[model samples]
Structures are given as structure tokens and as C-alpha cells.
Target: MSTTPDPTYHRPVMLAECLAALQLRPDGRYVDVTFGGGGHSAAILEQLGPDGHLYAFDQDADAEQQAQQLIRGPRGDRFTFIRANFSQLHDELGRRGALGLDGLLADLGVSSHQFDTPERGFSTRFDGPLDMRMNSEHGPSAADVVAQYSEAELHRIFGMYGEVTNARTLARTLAQARNARTIHTIADLKQAIQSCVPRGKENKYLAQVFQALRLEVNEEMEVLQALLTQSAQVLRPGGRLVVMSYHSLEDRLVKNYIGQGKFFGEAEKDLFGNVQRPFESVTRKPVTATEAELAQNNRARSAKLRVAERSSLMLS
Candidate 1:
């Protein structure tokens, strides 16, 4: 296994852009909800003074290990690493007596470390165990989802989460194949649904299938909703919310929540006709990677960054 301190463990996407979006205050408290390789956490710590505090959260044990390395380093005193999903943001902050943050940053989706590591099973490039849980120690793995979910359930996940075409057919195929042979590995899954994949779109097809399973196994959409809802309560007035999402599903949720303070439906209005919202969007449109950043890191290609600020009005 590679050492956690290695910089290449996971190269953070859009580092400068994220920092600029936060508009950090040297003495303010901040949170990095997805401290994958501690890259963003470390950067946030750099801008902080001795009085400032930075809380980092991640459910993955590997991430926790990387966080420990950061904690033991020179500026460790300024950092607090929480080993929990960002969905538990509110409770975790309350437990630590660290509510009302000045800024909160969430770099959503699977980290490069998770993708590059074959055993983690997050990448389509490698053939490994179909286990895509961010926190490998808990929850059902991708294999469990593929092996257990009904055809209907599978179809729903593939269609809604992965946006897979012919999701029903793919789900039925998996259901039949699993009964004949267990779908435990990445290779097994690909072979099981080989016939369903489009002639020239095998990679894309497999990605959709894997994405659906990963999302279901990790409850990503629900978790993202929880985080966005809690962030409204946790951030101080004018506090920043910076989120970088790789996929449209995650980006849409962030965009909608930031714009209207709710994921589904339009914003509710007061009797006076003023819209009541928790956070006002800072970036009118989602920001994407620059050509320069894209050249250096191909992963940045799909990233969409959105920023918002806590509203001062404090709606009931």
C-alpha cells in the first residue's frame, strides 16, 4: 500500500478555484466535507492563522489514515479530522461544539485515490472485486447490489442514478445472469451484461452500470441531499458553500439546492412575494475546469464547481 502522505495519492481538482471560491478568512472556522487525500484540507490550513480551525470529514478508512498524517504534521493543531460521512455534517458539528462555520467545501464523487486503486473497485479501467463502498468497512458492496436487487429495483437505479439507456433490458440481463453465476467481480459484471452494451460504447455502458451500483451501495444522492440541507443550518450569515461535482446528477442537486434552497420544486415565497431561501448563489452558473487544469488532470474535465453564500435574512 502507498503511504498516505504521498502527494500523488490523489491530486485535488481545481485547487486554486476552490480556495478563491471560499474567500477564506484567516481566523474563521471552515470545513472540508470530503477530505479524500487531505489536499484541500492542507490548503485550507495554509490560509489559516493560529486562531483558525479546520474540520475535515471522510468515511473512508484510507482517507482517515491520510488525515492522521496531516494531523501529525506541523500545522496539525489547526485541523480536526472527523471519520464520518459528510451527510452527518450537522450532528458531527454539534457534537464537536463547532457549529456555524464560515465556509464548507465538498468535492463530491469518488476521489482519484479510490478510482486508481484497483481493489476499491471504483474504476472501469481495472478488473477487481465489485466493491465500491466509500467506507469499505460498512454497508453493502456493489457485488451485493448486483447480486441481490430485483430486476425492477435494478432498472430504477440504472435509469435514475446512472442514466443508463435500455436500463430495463440491462437489469433483466443481470437478473438472469446472476441466477446462473454469481456477479462478484468487475469482470463477471461486464461479461454478464456484454450483450446489452452498444457496439462502440462498451466503456460508457459499463461505467453507467458501475455508477448505478456505486450510488446505490453508498446512498450518494440521499447523502448529498442531507449535506446540502444541513449546510443551510450550519453556515453563518454570508458564509460560503463551495461544491465541486463531477456528474450531472450531483451537479443538478447542488445547483437546485443552492438556487432555491430545496432540491425538488420551485422556491416558496412569502406573502409579500419575496422568495424564502437559505443560501444565495455566488456563482450564477457552475464553474468548470480551465484548459490548463484539464491538461494537467484529465479528471478535472467533468468537474462543475458551484458557490453559494448563506442568506442574512434567517427565514422561519
Candidate 2:
């Protein structure tokens, strides 16, 4: 049994890009949907002179608690931390009379806190229990998914979430191994995978397996879709929707939603021959981190930032 690694300080991805995309107004209201280390939130607060209000959301109990402590300075009252999933962001803000935000920032991906914490079961480097719930209070454990999900279901999960090359083979292997033994711990699951998966890059393969399990446990993609759909309605006209996605699956969703206003193709055209995209793409291509940022943070390698401004299209 190996001891857990020390929790490293989390650096927000594309800090400058996030701040610029928000287009902060002195009196504007803003939302940081994934306030991991509260870096982005703190930046927004700095831009907000006095009348600006910043509302941050983090589903993870640990993150929420940390955010409460982190925002304890002079500008504390201006920043409100909500301990709930951002899928229902609009409703949560609406209850507090926060309608039509001036801008919104959603750094959509697993946080460093979740990945570093051994007990969270997000990282393969750590030998923790097979638990990967973002909220920590809800959802089925990764162990349950590994033990209960059918081979086909597991295959779909790995293929969709992790983009694992041998998803089918891995899924079948998990299904076969788990039936004979109760796969309760992360070590048990990793060993089960290793039995079928030939070791080349152990870390890479384990990362994929862990990522698949985490996505299945948290339903991250589905929640992201929900949040994106709500963004068009919640943001004021000319308000910006800036997002940072770590993977292609998430980037595709963000790209499509911004361009077509839905996950699929564009809606029908009017007599004026307008394609009717609800949000105009601010950056034709996703903005990536600079060499300076990448040199300091390995996690920024996969980060892609997309920005869009709300169109005149009213909520349907």
C-alpha cells in the first residue's frame, strides 16, 4: 500500500485568456462555473471596482469549502460561492435575483483538487478507494460501475469518455474479472485492467481507465450539455460565454453549441437567409496557452479556450 502524494498547488489554466474573455465591466455580474482554485474568481473580483458581483460554483465539497476560506478578504462580499453543480446555475442565481449575467466563465474539466486528492479516486498515480464523485455527497462509486456495468456499457463509456484505443477489449476484461472477484479498491481495478492490457505506457493506460470511470461516475458530459443550453438563456445580449475544455469531446460540444446553438446542426433559416446562430464565435479557433504557461503547467497542454458573445435570439 503506497502513501498518497502531497496535494500540489492548483494553477488555473489560461488565466489571462479567461480574464480577457470575461470582458469585465465595473458593475457587471459574472459567474465562474468551475472555480477550482478560485484563481479566476479572484481575478474577476480585482476587475470589479465596487458594484460588480461575482458568483462562483463548485460541486466538490472540498473545493467549495476552500473557496469560502480563499474569498475572505476585503472583496469577500462581492464574491458568493455556491456549493452545487453548475448544471442548475441559472436557477441557483435566479433564486438570488441574479438574472442576465454580464458574462460567464466555465472551465469545464476535472479540477486539480479532484485529481490530486488520493481519496477522491481521480488519479491513477494514487492508490485510493474507487470513489470519484465530484460532489462527494452523491453519485455511484467507480467501483459500482466497474462491478455492475455490462461489458458493452463499459466499452461505450471508455470509448466515449477516454477515447481508449482498445476500449472493447478493456471493457470485456473488466466484466470478466469483476464477476469472479469483488473489485472494491483502485488497486484491484488497476490489476484487473493490467491483466488484459499489455504494459507499454502504464501511466497513460491507467489515466484513460481512471478518466473513463470518473466520467461515468460524474456524468460530466451530460451536465456540461445542460449548462451550455442554459447559458444562452441566462446570459444577457452581448454577454460573453467563455469556456476552457481539456478534451476533444468537450471542445466539440462547446464548438457546436456556440456555432449552431445546439449540439447538432443549425436551425432553419428565415426569409432574410440568416442561419440563426444564437451565439457569435469570438475566437474562430480555440485560444491555447502560451509557451510560458505550458512550461510551468503540464495540465495546460490539452486546455482549449473558446469564447462567444450572446446573440439577440431570445430563449425559446
Candidate 3:
């Protein structure tokens, strides 16, 4: 068997844009919650002075292993990697006496390495086990989701998360197919759902199906909500919340939370009708990749970066 080292990571989406969005401080405290391959974390460290510190969080063992390489660097002492989900941001940072963050950065979505690796199963192009958990060791695998979820539950995730056009049909198809045999691998899933795919839209439809399964298997939407909620409480006044998301669902949540301080509703109004919110929106609109950047990295095409700042006055 070949023992090739996996590539370090894909070029970070919107590298310059993300850096600018953070508005770095020489003595500030920062967090890179999605330290995939440590691209952005390394860059942030480069900008920090001796007093500045960075704490990164990732649950993936591969990512935690990769993080070790940074600890041996010249500025290693200034960095810390918490091998847990960013949803634990509050307690983890508090434990280290690292609260009152100056800025927080989250590059949300599966890392390129995870998607490209066949066994991880985030992509539809591979014929690997249907395991899509971000942590890999914990939670139910995508196979478990497919095999155990009732048709209605599968339908809910497919329609709500994937926005698959034929979500109902796809869910019913999987429900019936798995009844005959286990949909245990990527090939098994594709073959089982072949009849439900549209003729010329095979790739797009499968992508949606895979996306829905991945999101549900990982409980991504819930995790993101937890992270956003905790970020507001942790950031100090004027602290930055820089987030880059790949899909409409993630972006919508980020946009809403920053703009309204709540996930689904308007900001609450005080007695004087002053809108009370956690973070103030920095980007009037979501920032997308430039034509120049897009030419260099095709994956940057779907990226949407949104920056926000903790309100000057703390909210209850």
C-alpha cells in the first residue's frame, strides 16, 4: 500500500480577505475554530507580535495531528490547539483563562483534505464507506443515518438541509432500497438512488444528496448555532467575528445572527425602541471571491465571507 503523505491543505478561501476582516492586533487574543490544515492559523500567527496569542479548535484527529507541526515553530509558544468542536468555545477558552477574545475566525465546512480522502466520504466521487462524521470516531456514520432513519426523517433532512428538488422521492427511494439491502458505501448509495436522479443533473443531484447526509450525520447546523451563540458572549467590545461559509444555509444563519442577534427573528427593541443585538454587521453584504482569486482557486467560487463586530455595549 502507498504511504503518501496527504497534502497539507487546500489554499485557504479568501486568504487576504479573511486577514483584512480580522483587523489584527499585536497583543490581541484570537481563535481559529476551524483549523483545517492550519493555513489561516499560520497566517494569523505570522501577523501577531510576541504578546498576541491564538487558540485553535478542531475535533478531527488528522487536524489535531497536523496542529502539532505548528507547536514546534518559532512562535509555537503563542499558539494552542483545543481538540474539540468549536461549540465548546465558551468553556474551553474559559478553562484556559483565554476569554475576552479580540477576534474569532471560523472557516466553516469540510476541509478539502477530508472531502478528497475516499474513506471520509464527504464527496460523491468516491466509493468509500459512508462515514461522514467530522470527528470520525464519534456519532452516527452516514450509513447509520441511511439505514436507521425513517423515510420521514430522511425526507426532512434531505429537503431542509440539501434543498434537493426531489427530496421526498429520494428519501422514499433510500427507505425502500435499504429495506432490501444495506446502503453501506458511496457506491451502494448512488446505485440505490439511481432511479431518482434527473437525467442531465446527476452530479448536482448526488451532490445535494451527499450534502444532506453529511450535514445530518455531523449535526453541523446545530453545532454552528452553538458556536455563533457562544461567540457573542466571549468576544470583548469591538471584537471581530469573521466567518466564511460555503452554503446558503450556513450563510443565512451567520447573516441573520450578525444582523439581528438571533437566528430567525428581528433584534429585540429596548424600551426606547433601540434595537438590542450582540454583534453589528460589518459587511453590508456577504463578501465573495474576486475574479482574480477565483481564477486561482475554483473552490473559492461558493465561498461567502461575513464580518461582524461585538456591540460596544454588552447585551443581556
- Candidate lDDT (C-alpha), each: 0.91, 0.85, 0.90
Best model per TM-score: 1
Determine which window of 10 residues in candidate 3 has minimal summed lDDT: 1-10
Cα error, candidate 3, residue 94 (Å): 0.2
Descending-lDDT candidate ranking: 1, 3, 2
The TM-score between candidate 3 and the true structure equals: 0.97
Q: What are the runs in model 2 whose C-alpha is more than 4 Å off?
A: 1-8
Put the candidates in TM-score order, highest first.
Answer: 1, 3, 2
Residue 139 of model 3: what lDDT?
91
Cα displacement (Å) at residue 123, model 1: 1.0
lDDT tens string, model 2, 237-277? 99999999988888999999888767876666669987676
- Find the number of clashing residue pairs for candidate 3: 0
Give candidate 1's whole-model lDDT. 0.91
Over 4 Å off, model 1: 1-4
The deviation in Å at residue 118 for candidate 2 is 0.7
